[model samples]
Target chain A: MTAISGWGRYPINDTEMIHPRTVDAARRATVQANPGIARGNGRAYGDAAVGVRQTIEMAHLNRMRAFDPRTGQLTVEAGLLLTDLIATFLPRGFFPYVVPGTSFITVGGAIAADVHGKNHHCQGGFGQYVENILLVLPTGETIGASREEHPDLFRATIGGMGLTGTILEATIRLRPIETGWIRQRTFVADDLDTTIGALECGDSATYSVAWIDCLARGARLGRSLIFLGEHAALHHLGERHVANRFPLRKPSMSMPVDAPSFVLNRWTAAAFNELYFRAGARKAASSTLVPTHPYFFPLDALGNWNRMYGRRGFVEHQSVLPIKNAQTTLAEMLDRIAKRGESAFLAVLKKLGAGSGSLSFPMPGYTLALDFPIERGLFSVLDELDELVVAAGGRLYLAKDARQSRATFEAGYSDLSFFSEVRRTVDPAGKLKSRLAERLLI
Target chain B: MAAAEKAVLILGGTSDIGRATALAFAQSQWTVRLAGRSLADLQREADDISVRTGRQVTAHPFDVLDTDSFTVFVNALPDLPDVVISVVGLLGEQPRAETDLDHAKEILRTNYEGPALILRVFAEQFLGRGYGSIVGVSSVAGDRGRGSNYFYGSAKAGFSAFLSGLRNRLAINSSIQVMTVKPGFVRTKMAEHRKLPPLITATPAEVGEAILGGLNRRRDVIYVRSIWFFVMLIIRLMPERIFKRLKL
Candidate 1:
């Protein structure tokens, strides 16, 4: 048994990890092992992909099955990483329709989490682009799920958190692109109201997100810098890149070791936030052409960056609030966080459109994601925040949740009954299980 | 005149390193042919690489143990490949190999004799063509045999020596290049059971790039991690009186 943890590095578990190379081997292992869960790259940030009995690592099962260039349809194994897909096709003028904060995630994890990207306000979640899935049921029976076939099961499995079955492969639609560049327009919002207004104003953009300063209080509370972007057309390319529009470069900076917990205290966080806001404001002079990497995934430039949060690790509380009164609710939540005096190092706010899938996290609202180091009394503070979210008829994103109570989850996801019914139909005995499922009593 | 497309044939194509190397070569605009025991698995890999790189890829069945079929396999190819790589290896349980003669023989044959024999066949073909590159994937464990896994280590040692002799023989004409790749603790299926040091263990893709780089430079022998060269040299030069006492 090897000790493993999610990307957060907290809540470690000793699991019998199985690595299978082929689809047949994966099915056989699932059939023979005890209750288990399928893990892809371990990018979930929480225990949603870990199981005590077994955690089948699916990295080796990655392979491209087919591709139709005319229609931009690609079939790939579940273990294929989004990074590899982009490396192969980005130069060919194709890209995944939806990508989350990091492209290091696997296709299977994206589907299981129903992940959304900066463009979520317009394009929806990753599950919306998935055309079909080949799933290995708990009983080891392989079945196909798509919109026309097993539609209910399909919806449930999309964001079911891997409870329905182990995903073997998926067929997804890729969007055509002219270049690997984003034409970015930055806006600096003075406070919470302006931030919300800026996001609402940028809804027509293909992609939009904001970096908020949680430590700012009083007049500057919820002050943020919003970035809105659209894919750059061929004509937008400068002279240097016109000949080779899809230049890709790997990240070179990496955190070599776990930093001391004191490195992320309030003084450092406040100072960092101040400098960051100023730099962003200064850079907001005019529209700029940025590479896809920095425009969409700036944090990825630093590898193993989570190590900077310290060995105790950090937890991210991400919840989506309905449009109605979301501003007031966000103000109240930010007020509580500011009063607590604990630093939230990375806080993001994005607009979300209505999403498909029974357990999908979006609901045509605004989602605020806050990262706080695990320290004394932080859980209670997060508990209070959960209550505020629940009261506002919003739900927490399961992909980022590690400590929310079962009651809180049930209160948020009202479509649990449909998910449970599909679970019964596929895995009656609950042969497929995970730490997240156990904690949430799914 | 249009230049003919360069081609590479990879034996043991199902292995991680082989698959990765094939991808690297294909991405560089070379035709790739994958040969292994399972045509189905090889065909799937070929198709995947073909689609990803938009290069020509084909699969054929070849077994290292079946030496008699080597000639037939080479003859059946549509065209002679410019480069051939052998990446077959087996890491049997040390305890089982120590006690069971069948397991011991299987380990030795799989790691040493089989790869050597297959490469010899390809070397002959390359000599007839007057130009070619041959790469053999060996291991650092062969540098100095350890008490814990001498059976596997010794086989790799023999394979390494065989590659050296082949390189020496091919240099007589100075046209064929024989390269031996000694990777240390790669993070592949063969080493998954052991908890390798993250600092030293290389991903298969790293090994693939190293192999391609070594071939491009015409390096006779290359270590995936440069640190392994010093580590192995120290172990090889260690006094037997002191080395035999400690566990590796």
Candidate 2:
């Protein structure tokens, strides 16, 4: 047994890890004495990928099975990393329809979390692009599930957190692109209403996101800069852009050690926020054409950036509310956070389109994500925020959740009973379980 | 038409190192044929490589213990392979083989007789064609016998000697090449239960790439991690008077 933790580096657990190189080996591992969960790159931010007893490291099972260039349909083993896909296909004028903030995640992890990206307003969640999934059930039987067949099990497994079974493989539809550059434009907002208004009016762009200054107060409350982008067409590219297309530059910088806890106090956070906001304001000029790496995955440039939160690590609170209550709910949460003198180092907000799947996190509204270091009274504050979110009919993203009450989870997801019914039918004895499932009473 | 794709034949295709080596060769545009005990066990890897690299990969039935079928196996291939790799090895229960004669014999045959016979068959074919490369996966355990697993070690030692002599004989014509790969503490299914030292352990992919590099350079002998070369040299040079007293 070895100690393993998710990307957040919190709640570490000693797990018996097995790396299966083939599908048959993975199936045999599921029937082992200890029940386990499938873990892919351990990027789910919490205990969702770490089981108490065992963890099947699916990285070795990565393999490409089939790909049709005409229709842009790709069949790949569930362990294939998104980074590998982009490195192999982006140069060939293809990209995943939806991609999360980090390319380190695997196909299985993406489906289990139903992760949404900056383009959620146009492409929806990652699960929306999946056409079919092959699952290895607890009974050691491999079955295919899709929208047309076994729809209930398919829906339940999309965001089921590996409680249903081990995802063996999946078929996803990739979107075609002329080049690997993004035409980007930035808009600065001084307050909450302006930020929300800018995001709502920027529907013409395919990809949209906002970086908020959670430490700002009074007239500067909810100060943010919204970025909108569309794929750069082939005709728009100049000689230099076309000559150096599809450059996948590796991260040049990384945090070698954990920073001291005192380094990220409210004063430091507020100063950084001021500098960022001013920089954005200065850049509000003619649109710029940026490479895909910096445009979509800005944080990825600094590997292990989470270590800056200190030894206690941090928790990401990401929640979505209906369009009608999104503005008020977000404002209330931000106001409460600021009043308590607590500020997050990074804050992101994005608009989402209609959600799919029974337990998918996205809905037709705005979602706000904030990262707060673990400290005294942090849980109580998050608990109060959870109540506010529940009252506004918003649910937390389970992928980023390390702590949330069972009652809150049950109350937030209205289709819990249906998901439970499908899960029970598929895994009656519950051979596949994770710590997060136990915490949420799934 | 473009020159016919060069081909590589991999024995024991289900082994972790074999599959990784096959994929590496396929990525280099080589048509791969994976042979193991059962086609079903090899089908997944063959299909995966075919799709990922757009290369032709096929599965065939081959049992290393069935020495009589070696000639037929080579004859049945669609096209003569430009390179052949033998990754057949078995680490049976060391403690059990210590007392059980049958278990010891099985280990000896799996590590020595079976692989040696198969390579001999391929060596003859390559001699007639006047071109080809033969890679035999040996082990550092063969350098000096240890009390822990001498039965398996002795068999590997015999295989290593056979490869050395084969290299000497085949290099006379300078058309066919024979290379011996010595891998130390690879992280494969066979080594899952063993507690390996972290500094010396190498992944199967690492070993696979080393094999390809060794073949391309036509080396007489290559160690996967390179550090194992010195580690084995010290062990082999140890005086027997003191070496026999130690339990390692």
Candidate 3:
């Protein structure tokens, strides 16, 4: 047994980990004495991907089963990462329809979380693009689940947090692109009202997101810089950019050691936010053409960026409020943080479209995600925020939640009973359970 | 006929290192044939390679312990391979092998007898055709038999000596070439549990690249990581009196 943790590096657990290379081996792993959870890249920021006793690392099972260039449909093993897919097909004019902030997550993990990207307002979550899935049950029975066959299982497995079973393979539809360049526009919003106005105006863009200055208070409350982007067409690219249609570069530098907690205080964060806002305002026409990597995943350029939060690690709290109440709920939450002198190092706000799955964490609204380093009484502050969010008819994303009460979770998601009923029927013995599942009574 | 597509046959193709070598050759436009006890397991790998590299890859059944079927297995191939690589090895439990005779015998048969006999069959065909190359995957453990894994080490020692003698016999009589490969601490399914130092350990893909490079250069003996050549020299030069008193 060895110690393993998710991306946040909090709540580490000692578990028996196995890497199975084939479907038969994966089936055998499901029948082990201890209940197992299939881990893909461990990018989920909490205990949802970590098991109590056993964790099955699915890196070795990555294989591309089939790819039809004409239809742009690809069948791949569950362990294949989005980064690998981009490297292989981006040059051939293909890209995933919906991609999360980071491209390091696995296909199975993406489906389990039903991850949404900047284009969520137009494309929807990752589950919407899934054609079908192959699952290996705890009883060692392999079944193919799709819209037509086992529709209930299909809905439960997507955004199911891997509680139903281990996902073996999946067939997903890929979007065709002319190039890997993104034409982007930046707008600086001085306060919450302006930020919300900018986001609403850019709802028709292919992709749109906002970087919020959570430390800003008074007249500058909820100040943010909104970025809007669309895939660059062949005719839109410059001569120099055409030569490198698909470009990928490894992280130029990395955090070799953990930083001191005191180094990331309110003073440093405020200065950084000021400089970032000013930099965005300086650009003429507030527009530029950038490679997909930097435009989509800025944090990925600095490897081990999480270590900057120090040894105690951090908790990423991402909550979504219905559009009707989003502006008020978000302003109240931001005011609470500023009043306490507690600042989030990174805060993101995005608009989400309609959702379909039972446990999917998206709606026709706005979602705010923030990262705060663990410290004394941090849980109490987060608990208070949860009450406000629940009252506003908002829900926390399971993929990023580390500490949330069962009552809060139940209040946020009204379909909890239906999800529980489906889970019990599929996994009656509770042979597949995660720490997050047990904590939330899912 | 498109130059009859040069091919290589891997004996233990289910192994990580063996699969990597098959992929390397297939990427270079070589037809690959993978042989192992279970054709079903091998077929999955074959299909994966075919999709990735768009090359001709086929899997066949061959039991290393079944000596009687060796000739039949080779004759059943669609075309005689231009190169044959022997990667079959068993690192059985050292403590169990030391106490149980059956475990010791299994280590010897898997590492030495099985691979040596299968290569002998291919060597005969190459000698008659006056062309082809044979590569044997030996280990640095064979250079000096340590008490921890001497059962597996001794079998590799025998395989290394066999390849050396075969090289000398074919040097003047025929163009058939024999090469011995000694690797130190390659990261694969076989060495997953071992606590190996990261700097000295090489990945299976690295070992595969070295093997292909060595075959292209036709070197008589090569080490996967060149540092292992000097490390083994120091071990071989130690006096018996000093070595016997200390544990390796």
Per-residue lDDT for A5 in model 2? 80
Point out the worst 10-residue segment of candidate 2 chain A by lDDT. A27-36
Listed per prediction, chain B TM-scores read 0.96, 0.96, 0.97
Model 1 misplaced stretches (Cα beyond 4 Å)? B1-4, B123-131, B138-187, B195-248
- What are the per-residue Cα lDDT tens digits for candidate 1 across A49-167? 89859998899877998999999999999999998899889999999999898888899999999999999999999999999999999788998999999899899989878888999
CAPRI verdict (incorrect, acceptable, medium, high) for model 2: medium
lDDT for A156 (candidate 2): 87
For candidate 3, lDDT tens digit of each residue in A2-82? 887788888787888888888778778876626768889899998898776788888888877777889888888899999
> TM-scores across all candidates?
0.91, 0.93, 0.94
* Proportion of native contacts kept per candidate: 0.83, 0.56, 0.39
DockQ of 2: 0.53
Clashes counted in candidate 2 amount to: 0
| iRMSD (Å), candidate 1 | 0.8
For model 3 chain B, give the 10-residue run with minimal summed lDDT. B1-10
The best candidate in terms of TM-score: 3
Q: Count backbone clashes in candidate 1.
A: 0
- Output the worst ten-in-a-row residue range by lDDT, candidate 1 chain B: B1-10
